[model samples]
Structures are given as structure tokens and as C-alpha cells.
Target: MKRKMAMSKVPGYLVEVDHWNNEKEHTVLLAENSLLICKYDFVMLRCERIQRIPLNCIDRICHGEFTFPQKSLNKREGEGLRIIWDRLREPTFLSRWNPFSGDFPFCTFTKHPVLEANDKFTKMCALDQFMDQLTQAVQRAHEKKPIPGNANRVPVLKHPILIETYVGLMSFIGNQNKLGFCLARGNMGF
Candidate 1:
């Protein structure tokens, strides 16, 4: 089983943490069939949760500045990549209340931290390369689909999602910044 999984990894792709992971970095693996987010405990590097998003369902990908209402507290400062799929546009009020509500249809990505420290790691986890690879994988997934129902629809999710927002409550700030993200502080109060 492990051997099969190893064979499925999309070459030239490796770990690059997105902002959704908060302060702690998460390993993101781009497998041929799906995108996997591996959450690990910092101390022992034990895998706690693995959230997988299949490539076929991906409908849109956007790379741009993080835009929010002018007065929004959650407005972040930088360009980010958002990967969207076909699903409900908004989350329910109750679901938004959940700290672990990472079940959103889209995943936003930011520059990986490791890229800042070393140029070698930067190339391995380059955002542009990742985006290109993801686009190719999505195209392959859609092109090979044998579903009769999808025959009439577009054969590929080649659209770039640009709609940021007009104005409304900011849900992404809380939803993406999970409780586990910023739990660690270096000092530890000696």
C-alpha cells in the first residue's frame, strides 16, 4: 500500500505550508489523484490529521492579493493563492462558529516560510511551479473522466477565479486560522 502511494506522488512537488496553517507549518503533498494536507505534531513530527482534496473537483484557481473589507480586522497583508471547487458559496452561520471548520470549498495559500530561509527549499516549493503542476493535473483528471453525465459539460477546470469579494462578514479569517496553528511560542517562559 505504501509503495503504491509513493508511486502516485507528482514529481517536483513537495512540502510548502500555506497561511491556513497559521504559524506552524504543514506538509502539503501533491499526489497524482489528490492534494493532501498533513498536520503533524511539532515535537515528535507525528501525523495527526490528513485532509485530502481530490484534483477532479477543483474548478478554479486564483493568485492575488488578500482582499477584504477595508475595515475588516481579519484583512491580511500579502498575495495568496485560492483553490476553489464546485460547492456551496457560503458556509452556514453555525458551521462558521466551529474553530475547526476547514470544510470550505476553497483553500487559500500563501508564501511558504522555508522559502525565505534557503534558496534550495524555495525552488522545491515554488508557488508558481506548484500552480502550473496543479493546473496540468486538474486538466488530466477532467480529460480522463468517463462519466456519462459529465459528457456535456466542460472537459476541464481551466478557469482562473478572480472574484475576491464586494463586502460582507469576513469568514475566512477565523475559519482558516485554526486553534492548532499558533499554539506554540518559542520562549516557553523559562
Candidate 2:
């Protein structure tokens, strides 16, 4: 079988859900002020950043095992991190199906199962270090957000992972079709 491949995360699973619900490979760009998600453009041979989350807007940074609703078809089980900046709002059935909806308030990341058995990916993996740096940066940025008079009342960044899911839909088929861990070409002219 021909193995399909994309940019691989060495530590654990790091799957990013696209707007269409397809699992896509992304490079995590850790910048001083914002985190950027970059996608590799095969033709350009360079990663293009497609999304940005400002550090100060981060209201929470959490780590835990993924928890999905029982009916979710694409339930993923593994320890992961979730970054949230905005408040989560309940989705209406109509809004849930909207293809052009705005971005979700949070991003979820977990260790890739494929890397679990690969020794080459283990020895030097520094996800913990990365998280430490990120947490510090977020904390510093978070501290700067409170107004002058209410320093003590500023909301502390919550460390608990809160999942906001509406049964995985389009991504279910896409995940099933992935070539190995990366997204794959579909049989019908994918």
C-alpha cells in the first residue's frame, strides 16, 4: 500500500480540524504575540500561515484526554491540549450545519498515535518544554489584560480542557480516508 504522508508532529498526535471538518496537517508557529497555524504548500515548498490566535486573547490553556460525546463518530482518545480565547456559545442546528461559520473559540491538540511507537520521534521531543514556554507567554500576556483598578479580579486562565463539539460530520469520512495519519486522496478524483 502506498503510504500517504504530510508534515509529521514528532511528539504525540496533533490533528487540526479544518473549517470543512477535514483533518489537516499544520505547522505550529509559536510567536511572541500570537500562535500561527501554517500549512505546507507543495508547489511553493514553504509553509503558509493560515490562522492566528493572539496571546493576550487566550482565556485558557488546558491539557487532558479528549472527551467526546457518545454519539460522536470521530471520537479521539488521548491526552491533549486545548487553547481557548473566546466564550463558547451553544450552536443552533442551522448554525451547526453552516459551512461558512466563524472560527471556534478553541483549538484541540493531542499526541499522534502513530508517533507513540516510533523511537526516532521520542528521544528529543520537547512538547513539554514548548508548552511551558507557551504557558508563560500566555500568562504574561493574560496578566497585561486586566484593567488598572481591578488587578485582583481579573479572570485567571483556566487550565481545565473544555470540549465544545457538535457531532463530527464531514471530518468523519475524511478521517476514515486518511492515508496513514495524514489526509488522503479520495477514490473519486480526490
Candidate 3:
């Protein structure tokens, strides 16, 4: 026979930490209430009875050597890229303490029972797929090269001043065109 009880939820932000083990292997640490959740294969570490370390106070452990995915951005692509970067850099669910203030609408769920693990796994998978697609699109855009101009061009003017002015104007026009293309492709509302 199976028995179940309603799970109580805690409130806090979810942060991921990477640490290197003695074997120099990277491991992700997820902590809540002093209980550390390592990789699926590692044993869970219980630090609850010990002094609780404030999330902000914990010195981030840096392994010095780590590979990070590259992202591309165009100047014409306004606030969208900035917003995405900001959200990823510091993600936090706002507390719904004051309803009048018009804060976060969704309720925060921190401590759910193991029975809901399947649902959590599905959500995590969806998030990972979405991020992967975003990263690929950015990389492809960065790899694209600018169009080549006339190679075997004829000299239209002999005056040095005229040539310099004409070249400057051409450069400006080319930049404007590139910026316009980026803006159009971005489909930015603002």
C-alpha cells in the first residue's frame, strides 16, 4: 500500500554551482536547506545540522578552467538580447508577499516530494531543449560573413579627398544596410 502527504514548499532562488572533485571532474551542486544535491550518481550531502550558509555569502568555487558556449549579438537587435542576458545572469522568482505591489504572479515551489520528480524532469528537459536551440541560432548568425564588394573595380576619381569621402560614405551605407537587415530579422517590437 502507498501513502502520501501534501508536500510543503520553501521559498528561495534556484542557483547552480559547479565544483571540481578530487579527480578533477566537474560536478554541479544544487542546495536547499543545507542539503546538497550533487550529480545523479553521487551521494547526497546533508549540511542541514551545520550552520546554514547564506546563498549570497557563499564564495563561488571557480575551477579556473571551464568551457562556455559562445553567443552572438548584433547592435541592431535592441533590448531583447539585453533582457535575455540579464535574466540568465541573475534569475530569481519574486516573492508574492505584497499583492498590491504587483510582483511575480506565479507561486514559488521549492520543496516538493519525490513523487513529483517525473514532472520536474519533464520541465527541466523542455528548458534545456529551448536553450540549446537559442544557442545554435546565435552561433549560426555569428558565423555568417559579410557580403563581398567589387574586387576588380575601376577608379572613378583621381582626387585623394574625393576618394576618401566616397569611401567613407560607402562604408556608412554598408553599415546601415547591415543594421537594417539585423533589425528586420530580429522582429523587435521596440
Candidate 4:
């Protein structure tokens, strides 16, 4: 039952945090809430919480690696990327709200589940799609293309994935004075 739930949704651009207990090791996956966008040179994690961190705030981005210490001579099981943010940037997440506990400094997916050999192909496909989306979003921001229109009507670059059209235009935004083209990519419910 737990494996079924874990395999249902794949974390897109996630950071793996290591937790060790004696002979066993655990990997916690941190899920990103939304698109990684650079707004005015600030590489912002526009999560549901809306935290902003400058590009320089990132200490390093290690890809295809895991920093967890191994317990035995056996080969390591998981390998993924991690982003080290500058401590000074205060990247803490609200751990608890009732009593307002200490800052978590990061967010992670709760369940630590392992993938079986048969499930590897599907997981890899999902991971590839996640990476592609992150890459495209970051690349678009870095290119510094004008964001199409004004605040009311945002001009999104013409991308097949981002743009959607139906019987009527479902990707446009406008105000009384101005209009903008906005692309609601993932959520395109008619």
C-alpha cells in the first residue's frame, strides 16, 4: 500500500537529504512546488510559500551524486542532484505552525520509498520529464526574453508545452486598460 502511494507521484526537481541511523541510511526527497524562475535576476523558488533567493545565493549545484555515507562495502543505491544554498540566505521552511517550531531550512517529501527493478523504467521516464521542464524554464529565464506583455497580459514565449488553445483562447489575460498573454501550462482544465 505504501509503495503504491509513493510510486503514484514522482518528485520533479527534488533534493535528496541523507539521514543515517547506525547501519541503515535514509534518503529524504524535497519537492519543488512550482517552476524555477528567475525574476529580475533573482533565482526564485516560487513555491506555495513564495521564497526568493538570488542566483548568487546558491553555493553549488551537484548533479548525479549523493553525499550520504555508506554503511557497508556494498554499492550505493540512490544517486541524484542537490542544491546547496548559502546559509545567509535563510532558506528555512516553516516546520510547524501550531506552536511555531524551529525553522526546517528545507522541505522534503515525507515517505522515503525505494524503487524496484521493474519500476525503474517508469521512474526514469518521469525523472527525465521533470528535468526537461526545469531545464526549459531556467533556460527561458536566462535568455532574458521580454515577458511578452504587461502585468495584466503576460506575453509568454510561444512554446508548445506552455501554450494551450481550445475552442476559445484559454491563455490570455487582460484588464480594462491593458491585456496580456499568459500560459497556464500544467493546469489547463477547460
Candidate 5:
């Protein structure tokens, strides 16, 4: 059967990486404040000193600095830490487009039989919630109140669910039309 295409809109965060070790024990020393990590191959690094090294060579390590956009920082220490960590991780596609806008999108495919399998989808939901909170914090900082029921004000997509539903609906309509056409043809043949 031919496969159908699907897409989704999601929010992403940036992360810094301190260190990572491959199965063969090869290590990649990434930016100390980077959050995005190799989920299957390596574990997240936790260290006292965060450093920035050349993307090509680890031995070329050096102290690096990053500055968040003005008015983005707030009084909450925890929020600040999370935002900084997320920025390091590189969570969303929009990160590259416009850091201030905080818009991003992501899409993936799966052949699993169970539709509601909890994996990346759950993570996406959590990230959406986090983004919503962050947006609210930003609004509050501007002396504005968050709109009721519009927490994230961001689009979060559950890819598998969306794909399945779309396919199912299309299939149902196609089958019904085919049945109706067959019935009409038989009546005319009579």
C-alpha cells in the first residue's frame, strides 16, 4: 500500500551537551551547556564547569558565552535555568529561524500497531506544556495576563494519532462512495 504523508507543528527547546561516550567508548565533548543528547548511544552529562568546544574537535575546548534576548529573562531562578538549558539543547526547528519568536515544527513516522503508544508523543506534550508556561511567564513579565484556556498558545501535534485519524476518515469515505456507486450500477444494469 502506498503511504500517506503527515506533518506536525511543535515547540522545541535548546540544550547544551557537556560530554558523551559512544558504545565503542569514543567520546564527543560538546558544549558544556548543550542539552540535546544521544538518547540511544550516550547519557546526559552533568558537570561543574560548562565549556564550549569546537564542533569539529574536542581538544579545541574553550570558555564560551551566550546571551539570552533582552526581556526574555525573568525573576524566577528555576525558569531561567530551564530556559538556558533548553536553549543549549536545541529543541525546535524554529530555534534556527528566529530565537525570539519561539516557533517550531517536527514530524516523524511509525508503523506500530498500537495507536496511543507513549514515547516521543508524551515528551512532545510535556514540552508543549513547558512552552505554554514559558509563554505565560513572558506575558506576565510584560504586565499582561495569560488568556484563559490558552496556556501554551502553541501548536502541539500527536503525529501518529493525527495520521491514523486522517487515514481512517478517508478510507471510510472512499468505501462508502464505492458501495454507493456499485449499488447504482447494479440498479442501472437491471
Candidate 6:
């Protein structure tokens, strides 16, 4: 049998694909801010993992830094960064299995899963650099809505449930799409 070759769009520029093949894990590349494209082969075994995320959909990134109180002789501390998508929907079963409903931690950006598992100091540096690059890219990509100075001129409704119910009913009758129904929910319920 033969093996297929994998290559990035740009050889030495725009895209820089990374490869890590060890006893612990294997990944062909970590492209953009939200994908871990993996490729591996062993004798008769072959596998590839692909995760494509739309960066425009990300709402923000969180950098968590904290320390735990010392129950022993020394205090334990850890730091990490996470990618917070504006929408909860994800393509993979791995992500779908662990939904980020604000109640749970978002898709982590810290220590590339493969690196974190190795427990090396390089993990910290890698995560820090990744966070910085991701943050910059997100800021540049995300567009902010400008608030009108006279925004207060518009009337504010005290009761919004009536409007919400009306939309929901209309969507039900019209058989609206997922996005339409989502809006009708008013709070993105489920």
C-alpha cells in the first residue's frame, strides 16, 4: 500500500504547519486560532483528525490565572487560556459531547492538548504565545457595533414576553429555520 501526502496552502509563509509525533500524541498542524489538524500512520494503521472552526463566530478569549489555597506545604497555582465562541454549536462529537453553556469551561487554547499532556515548561510558553496571537487576531476580526449617542431616544419596553411569544408563534406557523427559532426564543433557550 501507499501513504498520501499532506501539505499546507503556503509553504513558509501565511501558513506554518506543525508536526508532533510521539508516544503520547500526534498532530500534523495547528492552524489559525481554532483548528488542530492531525495526521498519523503506522504500518497498516492510518488516521486523521480535522477540526475546522469559524473564527468570526468567536465572541472572546478568556485567560484564567489563579491559585489554590495551600492545604499542604505549598500553594498550588495554574494559568490557562480558552476560546469562547459566541455560539454553542460545534461540528465535532468531542465538542458536542462537552457543550460550553457558560456553565462549563470553553474550548481551551492553553497548552495544546498534546503539549499539556507532556507536562513540560514549554507548554506554558506555547500557551502564552498562542493566547497573545489569538487575542490579536480576534480583536482585528471582530467588528464592534457603535451605539448612537441618542440611543436613549427609542422607547424601552417594560414587558418583552408578548413580543417574544408573537415571534415564537409566527416561527412555528412559518416553520422558520434554526436561526429564526433561536431568535424567537429571545434568550437562546437551549
CA lDDT of each candidate? 0.54, 0.54, 0.22, 0.28, 0.25, 0.33
lDDT ranking of the models: 1, 2, 6, 4, 5, 3
- Model 4 lDDT at residue 88: 45
Question: Mind giving the per-residue lDDT tens digits that candidate 5 earns over 1-190?
Answer: 9754221243222222111100111111222222122221122332223232211111111122222334432111111111221122434444443323323222111111221357664444343343444334343322333333333232222221111121233334433353211122532410
Compose the digit string of candidate 1's lDDT tens values, residues 27-105.
6777766777776665554678787877777766777655554444444455556676754467666544453456567
- Kindly provide the TM-score of model 2 when superposed on the true structure, using C-alpha atoms: 0.63
Off by over 4 Å in 4: 1-60, 69-76, 84-125, 145-190
Cα distance off (Å), candidate 2, residue 52: 1.6
Candidate 1 lDDT at 112 equals 56
Give the higher-lDDT candidate: 2 or 4. 2
Better of 2 and 3 by lDDT: 2
TM-score of each candidate structure, all chains considered together? 0.67, 0.63, 0.16, 0.30, 0.18, 0.36
The superposed Cα distance between candidate 4 and the true structure at residue 80, in angstroms, equals 1.2
Off by over 4 Å in 2: 1-13, 18-22, 42-44, 88-95, 99-102, 117-120, 123-129, 143-169, 179-190
With candidate 2 superimposed using the best TM-score fit, by how many Å does residue 44's alpha carbon deviate from the native? 5.6
Clashes of 1: 0
Report, for all candidates in order, the number of backbone clashes: 0, 5, 0, 3, 18, 0
Q: What's the lDDT of the predicted structure labeled candidate 4?
A: 0.28
Q: Which residue ranges in model 3 land beyond 4 Å of their true spot? A: 1-35, 42-54, 58-120, 124-190
Give the alpha carbon lDDT tens digit for every residue of 1-190 in model 6. Answer: 8755333232111111111000112332333433342333332255543444444445555566422223322221245444545334544544333322223223432233334444453443365565555555444334332223322111211211101021123233332233211122544331
